[model samples]
Target: METLLPKLDSVFSTDCVIFGFQANELKILLIDRNEEPYKGWRALPGYIVGQDESIDDAAERILYELTGLRGLHMEQFHTFGDVDRHPQGRVITVAYYALIRIDGQQELKPVTNFARAAYWHPVKDLGKLPFDHQKIFETGFRKIRRRLSYQPIAFELLPEKFTLTQLQTLYEAILNRKLDKRNFRKKMLSYGFLKELDEKQKGVSYRAAKLYRFDRRKYNKIFQNDLSVEG
Candidate 1:
Protein backbone atom coordinates (compact mmCIF):
# COMPACT_ATOMS: atom_id res chain seq x y z
CA MET A 1 0.00 0.00 0.00
CA GLU A 2 1.14 3.48 -0.76
CA THR A 3 0.44 6.50 1.45
CA LEU A 4 0.00 9.99 0.15
CA LEU A 5 0.23 13.34 1.92
CA PRO A 6 -1.73 16.41 0.90
CA LYS A 7 0.10 18.87 -1.35
CA LEU A 8 2.01 21.23 0.87
CA ASP A 9 2.06 24.93 0.10
CA SER A 10 4.12 25.87 3.14
CA VAL A 11 7.10 28.20 2.89
CA PHE A 12 9.57 29.87 5.21
CA SER A 13 10.34 33.55 5.82
CA THR A 14 12.76 35.50 7.97
CA ASP A 15 11.70 38.49 10.10
CA CYS A 16 14.20 40.65 11.91
CA VAL A 17 13.56 42.85 14.94
CA ILE A 18 16.70 44.92 14.98
CA PHE A 19 16.95 46.84 18.26
CA GLY A 20 19.10 49.88 18.82
CA PHE A 21 19.61 52.30 21.66
CA GLN A 22 19.74 55.94 20.63
CA ALA A 23 18.90 59.19 22.40
CA ASN A 24 18.43 57.13 25.54
CA GLU A 25 15.57 55.22 24.01
CA LEU A 26 15.06 51.67 22.72
CA LYS A 27 14.04 51.50 19.09
CA ILE A 28 13.40 48.80 16.48
CA LEU A 29 14.14 49.06 12.80
CA LEU A 30 11.02 49.08 10.60
CA ILE A 31 10.31 49.34 6.90
CA ASP A 32 7.45 50.99 5.10
CA ARG A 33 6.04 48.43 2.68
CA ASN A 34 5.87 49.65 -0.88
CA GLU A 35 3.74 46.77 -2.12
CA GLU A 36 0.37 45.51 -1.00
CA PRO A 37 -1.17 43.58 1.05
CA TYR A 38 -0.33 46.49 3.30
CA LYS A 39 1.34 49.14 1.25
CA GLY A 40 2.72 52.10 3.18
CA TRP A 41 2.27 50.26 6.45
CA ARG A 42 5.21 49.83 8.81
CA ALA A 43 6.54 46.31 9.24
CA LEU A 44 9.52 44.43 10.52
CA PRO A 45 12.30 43.86 7.97
CA GLY A 46 11.44 40.51 6.43
CA TYR A 47 11.26 38.49 3.25
CA ILE A 48 10.50 35.01 2.06
CA VAL A 49 13.28 32.46 2.46
CA GLY A 50 14.60 31.25 -0.84
CA GLN A 51 14.32 27.55 -1.66
CA ASP A 52 18.01 27.33 -2.51
CA GLU A 53 19.18 29.45 0.42
CA SER A 54 19.72 28.55 4.05
CA ILE A 55 17.46 30.37 6.51
CA ASP A 56 20.39 32.15 8.15
CA ASP A 57 21.79 33.18 4.78
CA ALA A 58 18.37 34.34 3.68
CA ALA A 59 18.09 36.40 6.85
CA GLU A 60 21.38 38.15 6.17
CA ARG A 61 20.50 38.79 2.57
CA ILE A 62 17.04 40.02 3.35
CA LEU A 63 18.29 42.32 6.13
CA TYR A 64 20.99 43.80 3.92
CA GLU A 65 18.64 44.19 1.00
CA LEU A 66 15.91 45.76 3.08
CA THR A 67 17.96 47.93 5.45
CA GLY A 68 21.34 48.30 3.74
CA LEU A 69 22.98 47.14 6.94
CA ARG A 70 25.54 44.36 7.33
CA GLY A 71 27.81 42.58 9.82
CA LEU A 72 25.48 43.02 12.83
CA HIS A 73 24.96 39.91 14.91
CA MET A 74 21.42 38.58 14.48
CA GLU A 75 20.21 35.72 16.67
CA GLN A 76 17.25 33.46 16.02
CA PHE A 77 14.63 34.04 18.70
CA HIS A 78 11.28 32.53 17.70
CA THR A 79 9.19 30.91 14.99
CA PHE A 80 5.70 32.14 14.08
CA GLY A 81 3.73 29.45 12.23
CA ASP A 82 0.11 30.48 12.74
CA VAL A 83 -2.04 29.31 9.87
CA ASP A 84 -3.40 32.80 9.17
CA ARG A 85 -0.17 34.71 9.67
CA HIS A 86 0.36 35.40 5.98
CA PRO A 87 -2.30 36.46 3.57
CA GLN A 88 -1.00 35.07 0.29
CA GLY A 89 0.19 31.65 1.42
CA ARG A 90 1.54 29.52 4.21
CA VAL A 91 4.53 31.53 5.43
CA ILE A 92 6.04 30.14 8.58
CA THR A 93 8.49 32.82 9.62
CA VAL A 94 11.60 32.41 11.68
CA ALA A 95 12.20 35.57 13.66
CA TYR A 96 15.67 36.92 14.40
CA TYR A 97 16.65 39.77 16.71
CA ALA A 98 19.80 41.82 16.97
CA LEU A 99 21.12 44.60 19.20
CA ILE A 100 23.07 47.25 17.33
CA ARG A 101 24.42 50.62 18.33
CA ILE A 102 22.77 53.33 16.23
CA ASP A 103 25.74 55.21 14.89
CA GLY A 104 25.44 58.40 12.87
CA GLN A 105 27.84 56.97 10.29
CA GLN A 106 25.45 54.13 9.42
CA GLU A 107 22.77 55.31 7.04
CA LEU A 108 19.36 53.56 6.77
CA LYS A 109 18.63 53.89 3.08
CA PRO A 110 16.81 50.71 2.07
CA VAL A 111 17.78 49.17 -1.27
CA THR A 112 14.80 46.83 -1.62
CA ASN A 113 11.81 46.90 -3.95
CA PHE A 114 9.49 45.71 -1.21
CA ALA A 115 10.07 48.67 1.08
CA ARG A 116 9.60 52.35 0.44
CA ALA A 117 11.87 53.28 3.32
CA ALA A 118 13.58 51.91 6.40
CA TYR A 119 13.61 53.75 9.73
CA TRP A 120 13.89 53.23 13.44
CA HIS A 121 10.77 53.58 15.61
CA PRO A 122 10.78 53.70 19.33
CA VAL A 123 9.62 50.32 20.65
CA LYS A 124 7.06 52.02 22.87
CA ASP A 125 5.55 54.08 20.03
CA LEU A 126 5.32 51.48 17.27
CA GLY A 127 1.66 51.62 16.36
CA LYS A 128 -0.10 48.52 14.96
CA LEU A 129 2.40 46.86 12.60
CA PRO A 130 1.47 44.56 9.71
CA PHE A 131 1.35 40.74 9.58
CA ASP A 132 1.72 39.74 13.17
CA HIS A 133 4.85 41.84 13.36
CA GLN A 134 3.66 43.60 16.49
CA LYS A 135 3.40 40.25 18.20
CA ILE A 136 6.80 39.32 16.86
CA PHE A 137 8.33 42.52 18.19
CA GLU A 138 6.67 42.09 21.57
CA THR A 139 8.01 38.56 21.83
CA GLY A 140 11.50 39.62 20.83
CA PHE A 141 11.43 42.46 23.36
CA ARG A 142 10.43 40.07 26.10
CA LYS A 143 13.22 37.71 25.17
CA ILE A 144 15.78 40.48 25.34
CA ARG A 145 14.42 41.70 28.65
CA ARG A 146 14.70 38.23 30.14
CA ARG A 147 18.10 37.62 28.60
CA LEU A 148 19.46 40.91 29.92
CA SER A 149 19.30 39.67 33.48
CA TYR A 150 21.86 36.99 32.67
CA GLN A 151 23.63 38.09 29.52
CA PRO A 152 25.82 41.07 28.68
CA ILE A 153 23.89 41.66 25.46
CA ALA A 154 23.14 45.25 26.56
CA PHE A 155 26.70 46.20 25.59
CA GLU A 156 25.82 45.69 21.94
CA LEU A 157 23.39 48.60 22.02
CA LEU A 158 25.81 51.03 23.64
CA PRO A 159 28.69 52.97 22.15
CA GLU A 160 32.14 51.36 22.12
CA LYS A 161 33.02 53.43 25.18
CA PHE A 162 30.05 54.44 27.34
CA THR A 163 29.49 55.99 30.74
CA LEU A 164 27.87 54.05 33.57
CA THR A 165 24.85 56.35 33.36
CA GLN A 166 24.56 55.59 29.66
CA LEU A 167 24.64 51.90 30.40
CA GLN A 168 21.92 52.31 33.04
CA THR A 169 19.78 54.31 30.65
CA LEU A 170 19.99 51.55 28.05
CA TYR A 171 18.93 49.00 30.62
CA GLU A 172 16.04 51.15 31.80
CA ALA A 173 14.90 51.65 28.23
CA ILE A 174 14.87 47.92 27.62
CA LEU A 175 13.36 47.04 30.98
CA ASN A 176 10.86 49.93 30.77
CA ARG A 177 11.45 51.01 34.33
CA LYS A 178 13.81 52.84 36.60
CA LEU A 179 16.61 50.84 38.12
CA ASP A 180 18.28 51.56 41.46
CA LYS A 181 21.23 53.70 40.46
CA ARG A 182 23.52 52.68 43.27
CA ASN A 183 22.59 49.01 43.08
CA PHE A 184 22.79 48.95 39.30
CA ARG A 185 26.20 50.55 39.32
CA LYS A 186 27.53 48.34 42.09
CA LYS A 187 26.21 45.15 40.52
CA MET A 188 27.54 45.97 37.07
CA LEU A 189 30.95 47.00 38.35
CA SER A 190 31.23 43.89 40.51
CA TYR A 191 30.98 41.74 37.39
CA GLY A 192 34.55 42.75 36.57
CA PHE A 193 33.86 42.73 32.82
CA LEU A 194 33.71 46.52 32.46
CA LYS A 195 37.06 48.16 31.66
CA GLU A 196 37.36 51.65 33.03
CA LEU A 197 39.10 53.94 30.56
CA ASP A 198 40.78 57.24 31.39
CA GLU A 199 38.49 58.94 28.89
CA LYS A 200 35.38 60.91 29.81
CA GLN A 201 32.27 61.98 28.01
CA LYS A 202 32.98 65.16 26.05
CA GLY A 203 30.94 68.07 24.71
CA VAL A 204 28.24 67.64 27.35
CA SER A 205 27.07 70.66 29.33
CA TYR A 206 27.20 68.80 32.64
CA ARG A 207 30.10 67.10 34.36
CA ALA A 208 31.73 64.55 32.14
CA ALA A 209 31.16 60.97 33.22
CA LYS A 210 34.09 58.55 33.08
CA LEU A 211 33.92 56.08 30.17
CA TYR A 212 33.99 52.30 30.34
CA ARG A 213 34.27 49.51 27.80
CA PHE A 214 33.04 45.98 27.87
CA ASP A 215 36.07 43.75 28.17
CA ARG A 216 35.54 40.86 25.77
CA ARG A 217 38.47 38.97 27.27
CA LYS A 218 37.00 39.06 30.74
CA TYR A 219 33.57 38.51 29.23
CA ASN A 220 34.85 35.31 27.64
CA LYS A 221 36.31 34.10 30.93
CA ILE A 222 33.00 34.81 32.67
CA PHE A 223 30.66 33.87 29.85
CA GLN A 224 29.59 30.71 31.62
CA ASN A 225 28.72 32.72 34.72
CA ASP A 226 26.15 35.47 34.83
CA LEU A 227 25.42 38.55 36.92
CA SER A 228 21.70 38.83 37.62
CA VAL A 229 20.05 42.22 38.30
CA GLU A 230 16.57 43.62 38.75
CA GLY A 231 14.94 46.74 37.39
Candidate 2:
Protein backbone atom coordinates (compact mmCIF):
# COMPACT_ATOMS: atom_id res chain seq x y z
CA MET A 1 0.00 0.00 0.00
CA GLU A 2 1.21 3.48 -0.82
CA THR A 3 0.95 6.39 1.68
CA LEU A 4 -0.16 9.84 0.65
CA LEU A 5 1.98 12.87 1.55
CA PRO A 6 0.42 15.99 3.01
CA LYS A 7 0.26 18.98 0.74
CA LEU A 8 2.53 21.82 1.86
CA ASP A 9 0.63 25.09 2.15
CA SER A 10 3.00 27.17 4.27
CA VAL A 11 6.31 28.80 3.35
CA PHE A 12 9.45 29.61 5.35
CA SER A 13 11.32 32.90 5.33
CA THR A 14 13.85 34.82 7.40
CA ASP A 15 13.99 38.39 8.68
CA CYS A 16 17.03 40.17 10.03
CA VAL A 17 17.01 42.64 12.93
CA ILE A 18 20.44 44.17 12.72
CA PHE A 19 21.02 46.67 15.48
CA GLY A 20 23.71 49.32 15.23
CA PHE A 21 24.90 52.07 17.52
CA GLN A 22 25.90 55.44 16.07
CA ALA A 23 25.73 59.07 17.17
CA ASN A 24 24.35 57.87 20.52
CA GLU A 25 21.29 56.23 18.93
CA LEU A 26 20.29 52.59 18.62
CA LYS A 27 19.07 51.85 15.12
CA ILE A 28 17.83 48.83 13.20
CA LEU A 29 18.31 48.17 9.49
CA LEU A 30 15.16 48.51 7.36
CA ILE A 31 14.51 48.31 3.66
CA ASP A 32 12.07 50.03 1.31
CA ARG A 33 10.03 47.28 -0.23
CA ASN A 34 9.47 47.60 -3.98
CA GLU A 35 7.08 44.69 -4.52
CA GLU A 36 3.39 44.55 -3.72
CA PRO A 37 1.66 43.61 -0.45
CA TYR A 38 3.07 46.93 0.83
CA LYS A 39 5.32 48.28 -1.82
CA GLY A 40 7.35 51.40 -1.04
CA TRP A 41 6.99 50.85 2.70
CA ARG A 42 9.91 50.34 5.07
CA ALA A 43 10.26 46.83 6.49
CA LEU A 44 12.87 44.47 7.87
CA PRO A 45 15.16 42.88 5.32
CA GLY A 46 13.53 39.53 4.63
CA TYR A 47 12.70 37.09 1.86
CA ILE A 48 11.39 33.61 1.30
CA VAL A 49 13.75 30.63 1.57
CA GLY A 50 14.52 28.54 -1.47
CA GLN A 51 13.21 24.98 -1.60
CA ASP A 52 16.67 23.37 -1.49
CA GLU A 53 18.46 25.78 0.85
CA SER A 54 18.79 25.48 4.61
CA ILE A 55 17.17 28.14 6.76
CA ASP A 56 20.54 29.49 7.94
CA ASP A 57 21.90 29.74 4.42
CA ALA A 58 18.70 31.37 3.24
CA ALA A 59 18.93 33.95 6.04
CA GLU A 60 22.40 35.07 5.03
CA ARG A 61 21.68 35.02 1.31
CA ILE A 62 18.42 36.92 1.63
CA LEU A 63 20.00 39.59 3.85
CA TYR A 64 22.87 40.20 1.45
CA GLU A 65 20.65 40.13 -1.58
CA LEU A 66 18.14 42.55 -0.16
CA THR A 67 20.47 44.89 1.78
CA GLY A 68 24.04 44.25 0.60
CA LEU A 69 25.11 43.39 4.14
CA ARG A 70 27.04 40.14 4.36
CA GLY A 71 29.36 38.22 6.69
CA LEU A 72 27.52 39.34 9.78
CA HIS A 73 27.38 36.66 12.49
CA MET A 74 23.64 36.81 13.06
CA GLU A 75 21.87 34.38 15.39
CA GLN A 76 18.31 33.05 15.18
CA PHE A 77 16.36 34.73 17.93
CA HIS A 78 12.64 34.12 17.34
CA THR A 79 10.04 32.88 14.89
CA PHE A 80 6.83 34.62 13.82
CA GLY A 81 4.05 32.46 12.46
CA ASP A 82 0.84 34.39 12.76
CA VAL A 83 -1.70 33.18 10.22
CA ASP A 84 -2.23 36.62 8.72
CA ARG A 85 1.35 37.79 8.98
CA HIS A 86 1.82 37.84 5.23
CA PRO A 87 -0.78 39.10 2.85
CA GLN A 88 0.41 37.01 -0.07
CA GLY A 89 0.49 33.57 1.60
CA ARG A 90 1.06 31.52 4.69
CA VAL A 91 4.63 32.74 5.29
CA ILE A 92 6.21 31.86 8.61
CA THR A 93 9.33 33.95 9.27
CA VAL A 94 12.31 33.12 11.42
CA ALA A 95 14.03 36.21 12.74
CA TYR A 96 17.77 36.60 13.15
CA TYR A 97 19.55 39.42 14.97
CA ALA A 98 23.04 40.88 15.30
CA LEU A 99 24.66 43.86 16.93
CA ILE A 100 27.27 45.74 14.93
CA ARG A 101 29.13 49.01 14.72
CA ILE A 102 27.66 51.41 12.17
CA ASP A 103 30.38 52.85 9.96
CA GLY A 104 29.66 55.93 7.90
CA GLN A 105 32.18 54.84 5.30
CA GLN A 106 30.06 51.93 4.12
CA GLU A 107 26.96 52.56 2.01
CA LEU A 108 23.88 50.31 1.92
CA LYS A 109 23.15 49.18 -1.63
CA PRO A 110 20.34 46.77 -2.38
CA VAL A 111 21.35 44.31 -5.06
CA THR A 112 17.82 43.07 -5.68
CA ASN A 113 14.89 44.92 -7.24
CA PHE A 114 12.71 43.70 -4.38
CA ALA A 115 14.02 46.56 -2.32
CA ARG A 116 14.43 50.15 -3.47
CA ALA A 117 16.82 51.19 -0.63
CA ALA A 118 18.24 50.00 2.67
CA TYR A 119 19.00 52.16 5.67
CA TRP A 120 18.95 52.39 9.43
CA HIS A 121 16.06 53.74 11.47
CA PRO A 122 16.01 54.57 15.13
CA VAL A 123 14.47 51.69 17.09
CA LYS A 124 12.74 53.90 19.61
CA ASP A 125 10.27 55.60 17.31
CA LEU A 126 10.20 53.27 14.35
CA GLY A 127 6.74 53.81 12.87
CA LYS A 128 4.53 50.95 11.69
CA LEU A 129 6.33 48.24 9.73
CA PRO A 130 4.58 45.95 7.27
CA PHE A 131 3.88 42.20 7.62
CA ASP A 132 3.81 41.90 11.40
CA HIS A 133 7.41 43.12 11.46
CA GLN A 134 6.77 45.60 14.26
CA LYS A 135 5.98 42.69 16.57
CA ILE A 136 9.01 40.78 15.32
CA PHE A 137 11.28 43.74 16.04
CA GLU A 138 9.95 44.11 19.56
CA THR A 139 10.53 40.42 20.27
CA GLY A 140 14.12 40.64 19.01
CA PHE A 141 14.73 43.78 21.01
CA ARG A 142 13.54 42.14 24.23
CA LYS A 143 15.76 39.14 23.61
CA ILE A 144 18.86 41.30 23.29
CA ARG A 145 18.01 43.30 26.38
CA ARG A 146 17.82 40.10 28.40
CA ARG A 147 21.05 38.81 26.88
CA LEU A 148 22.88 42.07 27.57
CA SER A 149 23.04 41.25 31.29
CA TYR A 150 24.99 38.01 30.84
CA GLN A 151 26.65 38.47 27.44
CA PRO A 152 29.34 40.85 26.24
CA ILE A 153 27.23 41.55 23.16
CA ALA A 154 27.28 45.29 23.65
CA PHE A 155 31.00 45.38 22.76
CA GLU A 156 30.12 44.07 19.31
CA LEU A 157 28.14 47.27 18.68
CA LEU A 158 30.99 49.58 19.64
CA PRO A 159 33.96 50.81 17.63
CA GLU A 160 37.49 49.46 18.04
CA LYS A 161 38.23 52.25 20.49
CA PHE A 162 35.38 54.01 22.26
CA THR A 163 35.00 56.42 25.12
CA LEU A 164 33.38 55.28 28.36
CA THR A 165 30.63 57.81 27.79
CA GLN A 166 29.98 56.30 24.40
CA LEU A 167 29.71 52.88 25.99
CA GLN A 168 27.26 54.18 28.56
CA THR A 169 25.22 55.85 25.88
CA LEU A 170 24.95 52.53 23.99
CA TYR A 171 23.76 50.78 27.14
CA GLU A 172 21.16 53.47 27.67
CA ALA A 173 19.99 53.14 24.11
CA ILE A 174 19.48 49.40 24.42
CA LEU A 175 17.89 49.53 27.86
CA ASN A 176 15.84 52.58 26.84
CA ARG A 177 16.63 54.44 30.04
CA LYS A 178 19.27 56.75 31.40
CA LEU A 179 21.90 55.21 33.61
CA ASP A 180 23.68 57.07 36.38
CA LYS A 181 27.08 57.81 34.86
CA ARG A 182 29.05 57.48 38.07
CA ASN A 183 27.64 54.07 38.96
CA PHE A 184 27.64 52.77 35.41
CA ARG A 185 31.29 53.63 34.84
CA LYS A 186 32.42 52.16 38.15
CA LYS A 187 30.57 48.91 37.50
CA MET A 188 31.80 48.54 33.91
CA LEU A 189 35.41 49.17 34.89
CA SER A 190 35.13 46.56 37.60
CA TYR A 191 34.70 43.88 34.91
CA GLY A 192 38.45 44.26 34.09
CA PHE A 193 37.84 43.63 30.39
CA LEU A 194 37.82 47.21 29.15
CA LYS A 195 41.42 48.20 28.51
CA GLU A 196 41.98 51.90 28.95
CA LEU A 197 43.88 53.22 25.96
CA ASP A 198 46.30 56.13 25.88
CA GLU A 199 43.94 57.82 23.46
CA LYS A 200 41.21 60.45 23.52
CA GLN A 201 38.27 61.42 21.38
CA LYS A 202 39.38 63.61 18.49
CA GLY A 203 37.64 66.45 16.61
CA VAL A 204 35.02 67.03 19.26
CA SER A 205 34.34 70.56 20.53
CA TYR A 206 33.69 69.21 23.99
CA ARG A 207 36.48 68.02 26.25
CA ALA A 208 37.89 64.70 25.11
CA ALA A 209 37.40 61.56 27.15
CA LYS A 210 39.71 58.59 27.57
CA LEU A 211 39.24 55.76 25.10
CA TYR A 212 38.92 52.07 25.93
CA ARG A 213 38.89 48.78 24.05
CA PHE A 214 37.15 45.52 24.94
CA ASP A 215 39.87 43.03 25.83
CA ARG A 216 38.48 39.89 24.28
CA ARG A 217 41.29 37.66 25.51
CA LYS A 218 40.69 38.70 29.09
CA TYR A 219 36.93 38.23 28.74
CA ASN A 220 37.42 34.76 27.27
CA LYS A 221 39.68 33.71 30.11
CA ILE A 222 37.31 35.01 32.76
CA PHE A 223 34.16 33.40 31.30
CA GLN A 224 35.85 30.19 30.19
CA ASN A 225 37.08 29.57 33.69
CA ASP A 226 33.57 29.98 35.05
CA LEU A 227 32.13 27.59 32.46
CA SER A 228 34.87 25.02 33.07
CA VAL A 229 34.27 25.02 36.79
CA GLU A 230 30.54 24.64 36.24
CA GLY A 231 31.07 21.79 33.81
Whole-model Cα lDDT of every candidate shown, in order:
0.90, 0.88
Per-residue lDDT of candidate 2, residues 1-231 (tens digit): 999999966689999999998788899999999999899999999999999999999999999998888888999998899888888778999999988888742578999999999998898879999989989999999998887877778888899999998888988898888888888888888777899998999999999999999999999877532211010
Clash totals in order: 0, 0
Indicate the residue-level lDDT of 29 in model 1. Answer: 97
Instruction: After superposing candidate 1 on the true structure, give the runs of residues whose Cα lies further than 4 Å from its correct spot.
Output: 1-6
**Model 1: per-residue Cα lDDT at residue 217:** 86
Steric clash pairs (candidate 2): none
Worst 10 residues of 2 by lDDT: 222-231
lDDT of 1: 0.90
How well is each residue in 1-231 modelled by candidate 1, as lDDT tens digits? 899999876699999999998888889999999998999999999999998999999999999899889877899999999989989977899999998889853688788789889988998898998999989999999999989877888998998999999999988888888889999999889888999999999999999999999998888886657657763
